[model samples]
Target: MTSASGFLHSLPMRQLRGVGPALAEKLAKLGINTVEDLLFLLPRQYEDRSQITPFGALIPGMTTLAEGEVKLADIALGRRRALLVRLRDHTGGLTLRFYHFRQSQKESYRPGLRVRVFGEVRLGPLGPEMVHPEVEFLSEETASPESGLTATLTPIYPLVDGLTQRRLRELMARALPLLDQTDALVDVLPARSSGGWTLADALRYVHAPPLDSDRRRLLAGEHPAQQRLAFEELVAHQLSLLQRRQRQRQWPAPACTDSAQLSEQFLHQLPFQLTHGQQTVLHEIRHDLQQPTPMLRLVQGDVGSGKTVVAALAACPVLAAGYQVAIMAPTEILAEQHRQRFQSWFEPLGIPVGWLAGKVTGKARQTQLNSIASGECRLVTGTHALFQDSVQFARLGLVIIDEQHRFGVEQRLALTRRGLASGFAPHQLIMTATPIPRTLAMSAYGDLDTSVIQGLPPGRQPIQTVVLPATRRDDLITRIAHHVASGQQVYWVCTLIEDNEQIQAQAAEVAADLLRESLPHLAIGLIHGQLKAADKAAIMAAFASGQIAVLVATTVIEVGVDVPNASLMVIENPERLGLSQLHQLRGRVGRGSAASFCVLLYQTPLSGLGRERLQILRDSQDGFVIAEKDLSLRGPGEVLGTRQTGDISFRMADLLRDQHLLEPARVLAEHLMRDNARLEQALLQRWVAEKDHYATV
Candidate 1:
């Protein structure tokens, strides 16, 4: 019970006896550069060799230990040549085949030799057999099957080709004793934090559970030792965020103040009234902007909840304070959409809206860059190009990131660094249509004050969602024609751009062609990722202006494309997508007073999970609810996106699985940062070290 002492010191793997440069390099390949890292590298599974299973008791698909005397050893010539050895115990005989083996290994497997083997049992050519089983020779004194059985469980680690399981175990054997002798590996957690187990005891127990250990519990990562370690890792992750969050607030940011004269004027100039949800979010952002410290707030709103309107409104205070506002979008389409919306709202008010994107090049790009830097353009909206080194902002104030998940931490930090170049960190506000559940938001980050923009805009009709089989798709065409006759447009969304050889879903172009044939009178348009950005924009523009009666497109239309006249949406093969995404696609409709409909045209014989996902979408209009369900179906990493969770690669903790630990981790992180100044830094260093990912400016 002394495998890992603690995080008091990060002893380099090279420092371990017998670990030379080559060995250390091999260890590094598996990310085990330090003794602490090696200890943290818990086995994915363990082999129970305490009691050898008899050949008769061996079941197919069971990984177990067995011992017998080799009765026959010869090369089996067939479609695939293999060295097959038959071993017979007192109960029965089992076959062990090796497709890849040395001649020496073949010679060693002589008939009448007593041997022990460990591997998974699977039905093979000669009944139940093990492929390339681990074999051990039993000498005359240890010929009994029970004599060679290991007293404790054998740990199986994730390893490279050169680093065998036995070698890794030997390394652990050497490291565990050091834990008891050295004072370096100190337990970072408080006495009460790690249940009743110290860090070293937990590590030791995890790495080498006794013969009586609950094998199932340890493999499932349900053991108390495992949970304690998961909790500690999660707390360390929170501590990292807490450190970054504190460092971020230390820098001064321009306080745009309550000079909402322009914001109010902009709101008054709008034809439509802001919903209560929009107002609430706007109020939160306004309050954040007025603070001296940089505002790192994440605003969550469902599609059609009017987040862009809120973003535009948030930017007004920065403009009124004579500071620039830069809005970053994920794609050119989204960025252009923001630019057009911002221009319409601000250009009339004499504030120039600058645009920068990957396509904007050479002199024209420089001209716009100059305008931004000269402070002539008070508002700028673009994709990642906005954070490029060449794109300098003149007194930048508020930096609003749209669809926050699309951008990673590096981009966030790049923009933060950009703001610092202007003498003060910019008040940052990020918006995402994927409304995060309260639990997810808290677990994902201890930073980023969240503002939930709930409810649709005043005139938005809750889209009536329906689930229908693909067999009824033809009937949908007629219904679409009738809907078009009534002056409403339709959107037919495809999951793919072109016909895929494997998947049966219709492609965007193929669906558009078929729709044109089905409704010869209706104008059909196609849009997808493969199309040029300008062409996609033009097609979207046509659809928006009602020139295209039916827009057959891929999932690229999931966000930033809003057309109030387009009411009916048919998502083809809706089962292939996540529920949250289906909600976003449906958000493209229901933007206006017209009663909207979303038809989930699914393939026949839907799987249970696919059916569940579709039904969840059909029932719930709340993005948060759908997101929570999505989070349940797909873990936190998939729901939150890898970009955001890249730095939060938990060694053991799963946000969804160990959600109970999130609040405790958050609370402990706060306490550690407040009370124990010295140990807090050490704890952070042990778990977080050089990996400093900033989520806030």
Candidate 2:
């Protein structure tokens, strides 16, 4: 109802005075295209420059505002040249060293000129010093007039090249009041939801708090104002995902209720029975499949909890409906495993299985593609190759994605589009072995209904974990020989494929060579990401068939690697990986009824965080518990593998710290969607960028 209501989100950074094209480009690098984005780019910390600290009272390691006359200015010639200017107050003296200075900049700090400085004081070789501190010319003498001090706690923001703190501060000062005059900062949430502060008041407090404001609370983001912003951001994200869910229902999907006979035959052929947990999850998937709308569901279970089996049964319904099914994996090895497993299960029931991947080249690749397009390959499994333009499906009814977080939004859209058969979209059943925390599952997968396999099958023994220093390498190798002599396989996981001094990780090739020399009678195999897909597949097969006594690999083997007889897992530099990754690597073993042990052969001088990560794995075998701890230590990006894998990154709300807001945000999002459509659209416009990706139709 006010002039300012819709302007902030639409206002460009260039609208601010002095922000030219070049300056706006720099801001764009920091994701600041709109005035609202700039406002939300809150300070990492703040400093108090309202009052000055006397040189005598300034202590090393403390940041303070101080002023004094320049005593001496000289160029110091050392290994690195530096311009050093000594300043003196009546009580004490300190030096300002600038390593990067132009001729004009160096000459500006002349002796006898008083200047105000703000920076951390550190004990230097000569005395206390401030390196490259912010320097403002005061006056020629103490008797002359000096500039006034900052009236409020100065906000310190993260910056890009060509953008300085002073420039950003001036822009904020100019633009903030523009919105205030028009009452633009309207509340999308109910009034009083933001810890009793209006959205405008919250932004003002966060951007420029009063001098007496709680510095500790502000620095730690514990203030009510910051919480207000965080809560709104969380709600916006929830609404965007829920909107995505609504769009999924808009697309017509193949309803698959005719799977009972086919699923029974597939189940009967299996040697093992489905665990109660698997059966429960399968029931949920079946109900979703019977819907005409696409099934958006994420199935989660701990490692070796029979998730793939549940997926197989889920596919039966789609297959029975006279349409095809496609299963996608993040890695070729995982995809191959699925292909073989599915062929073994389905080929007996008159269902043909097809495989497609980068490795399936020339005639083989074309044959597989033809089989898929010709309505012959009723079931197919592959890596991202399934998304290729050459690959097409006939009446594709269901799409199952394993390690769903490893694929990007575009890849998802591409595969879902391939199932555009006769005006109907394919149902999607996403699966993940990385146990997602309840709060995270609710937010990240809010677009999809979730069903988690409660626990591992009966009689599954917990993995025995042990932490050992790399100093025990020789002893561990000898133990490895003994383990291998007993006819059991072992996985020697190196963090690298080549020697990296910075990482201090032994390469898989080097480790394999060393292992071969130590145990001449045993067969050793090496695998890494650098290897061709065919080579990697060959090594994995050798290891699986017991031809390779020791399989040396990098973290490429972290996901969906199955080897039942591999009772021992020796991870080099286990400290380098997060708890979830380490847990996934551990899951590779302890897979069989035989007892399993995971040895964390960590290099010494491990950091506290690294040590804590290793300890968490050593103490507990629960993937969910380990994943929650990983989220806290590493944040959600790395936990979901999205930092390197996908576009699902959050701008403000941290899943670990603001988890308490998730359920409330979910509730509010649903209410807003039902009660007010205009507000829901506004919320999505403000927060989300990839709405097209969410529109799987």
Candidate 3:
């Protein structure tokens, strides 16, 4: 523990031996502001520098190391003058050419000096040669262990402008010795497993791997050193989630013990029976609701997997218990859909369902607010406006959040705070139709108990998907006209790659115009994010009632706009969208019993990833499969879309690749919290940084 107050942890990069202003500026671009940053900046790969190959054994186009005595040195006279050094080993001789050389470099390559050179070898006029090879001068003094005479590997790092591998290696060399004097690499995590390396040992091995190190494992991030770091990161995430869950449990929820009668009645009234998935999830929900501790559960189902029904079933018990329920949706359209569904289900049962949105204004909004405050509204659903400061829920018992990814943890917690009036927190059931990968489910929603509705309702038919070139627009239009003439509705989804809404709206407008021009007899409607809330609602209503044959809209209709009669989906430029999005859009059409078709009209010259994404959508209707593929192809950031919260941010661990460690990390985290609170706090401080400050308390 020599480096308890390690200089490497806090000392500025400028304090390093050779880091001047220019070099420091360049290093800053790579986030290397301190000596500790330099120490943690491990190598991307390594070169075998342990032994030099004989000049005769060097092969053309192979990067190798060779050592020889400099037999001749001269400046070659040509169109490009170069410093040429002829080096001879016992077996053969090779040439070293340096195009851009300094006077010092010229003086250093004197004849009769033994040198080690590393570079790609190529067949040359004089047998073989290396151009701009890395040259190291050897001394007549005996090779010493400290001088790396027996060291076999050289570190390669990702560099920025004005930074070279050689310079970074020299910097690491200067920084590594400081670790011996300081505790910069101290392991804060307990040694929970037998196989993992200590923090300091992992850092040392990763930064300067030996010749015998497994290069393949290092590159794949499967080495024991990398595994140690990954495990620590996973544990940090687990601890954050667990602490958050603990804080949530501190708040109590109204125990809904009499939910069985109303919940059974609500299910009995449904024309169809709940699927096994829904039944199982409801059982879990009932168990959570009975607990005095508030429920933090996530209901993840594929599109059209009856998530809304499950949500409604969960709400029945709370409503019957004389407590209010609030459902928050990401979009106004989605919120309205839930409101309509809930109204139909509850109004007959004498339970009032209330609606609140951004558009509800003046007297109507005040009336809704009054109803909620007076507790007349036993169940309420709306967009984010439900969390507005003016809105208050009387005896709020449960909060159901649909498409939870669209809302962050803070937003969810804001709703949870509303139920504090009863001296308890509300039970929260967050629902998302976008299937999450298993790793994300563990890392992102791990705090919550997860219930997944695996299968769709029995009566729904499978959707047939097709991919076509955008050049065949006329053919696609003809097919759409044919479907519309048969009294079937279609969705024309227009998407723009740019963030500009005006341009995106214009794209939808252009598509609408094209459809109107081609199919004059068919009624076409348009919608976009720029539209007024009322206008969007009106268009959706008309489309739902079969008044509009084709609805052209931006990605606004990607979620919660359920038009059962709309049996065909035409996604223009489908290649521009992610797999999850494409699947969601497709889900909009297949909701009805009539045979549905999803046309992915993509532009030609599609990138490999775009092609693969489209093909995946065509090949599988399973959202979970597409989600996993999307995570692998587009990465966790894009796959999670804009739902990224502070807890989900990963610096070293890849959820998709390092998923195997999540369970073990979670178990270890639980043990730490139970047996070693101080070590847990230290580990969170080291890895989660400032994010887990409250967990320490």
Find the candidate with the highest TM-score and give its number.
Answer: 1
For 142-181, candidate 2 gives per-residue lDDT tens digits of: 4343356778899999888878898889888887786575
By TM-score, the better pick of 1 and 3 is 1
TM-score of each: 0.93, 0.92, 0.78
Off by over 4 Å in 2: 1-37, 56-58, 71-74, 139-146, 178-182, 496-506, 605-611, 644-651, 689-691
lDDT by residue (178-246, candidate 3, tens digit) is 766545654655565625577777777777887788889877778888788778878978988888889
lDDT of 1 by residue, 89-179 (tens): 8988899999998888889988889999899999876677999988878999888646856677888888897888878988988887666
Clashing pairs in 2: 4-184
Please list all clashing residue pairs in model 3, or write none if there are none.
3-182, 3-183, 49-152, 50-152
lDDT for each candidate structure: 0.83, 0.83, 0.84
Alpha carbon lDDT at 207, candidate 2: 83
